[model samples]
Target: MIIAFWVSLFIILYTFIGYGFVLFLLIKIKRLFYTPASFDANLEFPSVTILVAAYNEEDIVDAKVENTLRLDYPQEKKQIIFVTDGSTDSTTEKLNRFNDVLVLHEDSRAGKMAAIKRAMPFVEGEILIFTDANTFLNDEAIKELVKHYRNHKVGAVAGEKRIFVDQTADASSAGEGFYWKYESLLKKWDYELYSNVGAAGELFSIRTRLYENVESDTIIDDHMIAMRIAEKRYIIAYEPKAYAMETASANTAEELKRKIRIAAGGIQSIFRLKKLQIPLIIRYLHFNTSVIVC
Candidate 1:
């Protein structure tokens, strides 16, 4: 009983706090003998396609389109696509109002991954960015994400997800914001140590050629897509400067529901990705941290 108790306590502590401290120490030690690579501003940028999947998000479609247009990437090299499969709202209509954006809509309500797969054939850019319809990205997001691909080994780059919480926010909102802040820090450390375990759907870009078709029913397609690339011995870089910002859930119940779904997905991913043969420490960290967070 004592042994079990001690082991359980160790896991809980390691999952929440000890891992971050360990990562910090490991990074400090690594920096002593290793020089991190720097991004070259003069390198020619590749063509990029920003793909957003929307479902009945008519109210925020216009804002998202405007935000995408305001991004700093070269207009000639950038392509914007909004997939509104199964949307019964004006999301498709509003997206159509933007001449610069391509709107793909179908009467069927396929899942998010299905929608992404449907839009894959039309992706003309060398880099494919997946983001939510409601989240807004920073102006330099595309530039920051694509710069890492200059490294041939980098298969994908994950942007940070920031939650907007005001002073009047409730406990759930504040907690969600704090959680993402901590998550962003962990991702930074993870990349420094080696590579990020997975990417968030809010804002992440991948080499179009490296993208494999994820299962159509994937609950968390972003994580799976990134992990599949990692399984191919490619690096998943994390860039904090490129971020997606969105509001917290409306209430505690909604937050709980979201987390529950994520937790379920994490469990499913564990079983599906059991073939991943990365370093044991990284695998452990990824699994435990995901379970704890959800």
Candidate 2:
């Protein structure tokens, strides 16, 4: 019983705090001998497909469209697509009005993962960016994400997710925002040491060819997609400058619901990606870290 008690306590502490501390030290030590590759601004930017999945998002659709259209990237090289697979509102209609945006909608209501899969075949860009409809991107987001792809070793790039909190917010908002801030720190260190565990759904980009079709019922498509690339021995680069700004969940109840779904998806992904736990030391270490937080 005493031994078990000590084990449990150790795991609790390590999982919550020690892991981050160790990762921080490891990253600092790694930088002593390692230098990240540089990007060539003169290189021709690759084509990008900004894919958005929306369901009953009529209220924010117009703003989202405007925000995406005004992004700081070459318009000629970007293909904007909004998939409203399960929407029964004016979302499809609103999106259709934008001639430059491709709207894919169907009366049937499938999950977000299914919606993304349905639109995958139509993507014509070398880089595929996945983002939530409600979140707004910084102007330099696409540029930052695509620039990392210049490194052949990088298969995916995860943009930071920033939560806006004001004085009017409650404890839930503060806590959630603080949590993402901590997550961003860990991601930065993870990138320095190795690669980010997974990509946040708010904003992440992947190489078109590296995208593997996940299960239609997958709950966390973004995490699964980015991790899949990591499994292929490719790095998921983290870019702090490229961010998706979003508000915290409406309340504690909503925040709890979101976390539960993510936890469930993490468990599901752990089982599905067991093969990534090969005997390789570095691979096993990274996979272990992913399981704890992803």
Candidate 3:
């Protein structure tokens, strides 16, 4: 029992705290020998499609549309598509008013993954960027993501997710905000050492050519999409400069529900993606350790 207790304690501490320290030390050593690669800004930007998925998001769809239209990318080089599958609100009607934006919807509610799949045929851009309708992105987010594509080895780019919290925020808001800060750090380290395990749904982009149809039953679409690209031996680059801003859950209950769903989906994804799992036993240890602690 003593041995088991010690073992469990070590696992928890190492996964939650020690790993970050170890990762930081390793990154410093790596920087001594490795100069990060850069892409030339002079190269022409590829066409990109900004795909936003919404379900009963009438309240925020207009703001999201405005935020998207305000992006810094050249108008001619980018296309916007909104998928509102099963949105019972004024989301579809509001989206239709955008002359340049394409809207895809069906009366019956299918899952977000299903909505993305249904909208795929209409995507003509060389790159596909996925974002949630409730989130707002920086004006240069797309531009920052596009620059990474200059490197042929980069198959996808994961943008940072920032949660807004303040003094009046509840426990969920504070906790989630703190968690994302740590997660962002981990993603940076992952980018330097290996590839990000998955991408956050708030904002992530992939090469259109590398895009594969995600399972309609998928619970975590962003992670699955990023992992699929990683399976092909392409790196999922992380760009902290490009980020999406979103509000925290109303309270702990809402946050708990969200976490539970994600946890279930994550477990489901692990099994589905087992065939494409990273082969190194050491990598597996690190992956599961971090997951459990999180």
Query: Scored by Cα lDDT, where does model 1 land?
Result: 0.87
- Model 1 residue runs over 4 Å out of place are 166-168, 277-294
Model 1: number of clashes? 0
Q: Write the per-residue lDDT of candidate 3 for residues 112-188, one digit (tens) a residue.
A: 88888888899999999999988999999998998988888899999999998756668769878888889799888
1-294, model 1: which lDDT tens digit per residue? 999999877877777788788888999999999998898798899999999999999888888899999999899999999989889877888888889998899999879999999999999999999999989999999999999998899999999999997566578898888888887998998898765775889999999999899888888899899988888888999999999999988678888888887777777777777677445455555554554454
Tens-digit lDDT string for candidate 2 (1-294): 999999877866665588788887887788788886678878889999999999999999999999999999999999999999878889999999999999998999888988888998999999999999999999989999999988899999999999987566668898888778877888888887665675899999999999998988888889889888888989989999999999887777777777777777876777787766453344334434433443
TM-score of candidate 2 against the unseen true structure: 0.92
Ten residues in sequence with the least summed lDDT for candidate 1: 277-286
> Each candidate's lDDT (Cα)?
0.87, 0.85, 0.85
Q: For candidate 2, what is the lDDT? A: 0.85
Indicate whether candidate 1 or candidate 2 has the larger TM-score: 1
As for TM-score, the candidate ahead, 1 or 3, is 1
What residue runs in model 3 are displaced by over 4 Å at the alpha carbon?
166-168, 278-294
Selected candidate, larger lDDT, 1 vs 3: 1
Q: Which lDDT value does model 1 have at 94?
A: 83
Best by lDDT: 1
Model 2, residue 143: C-alpha shift (Å): 0.4
Q: List the residue pairs that clash in candidate 2.
A: none
Error of 3 at 46 (Å): 0.6
- CA RMSD, predictions in order: 1.7, 2.7, 1.9
TM-score for candidate 1, residues paired by index: 0.95
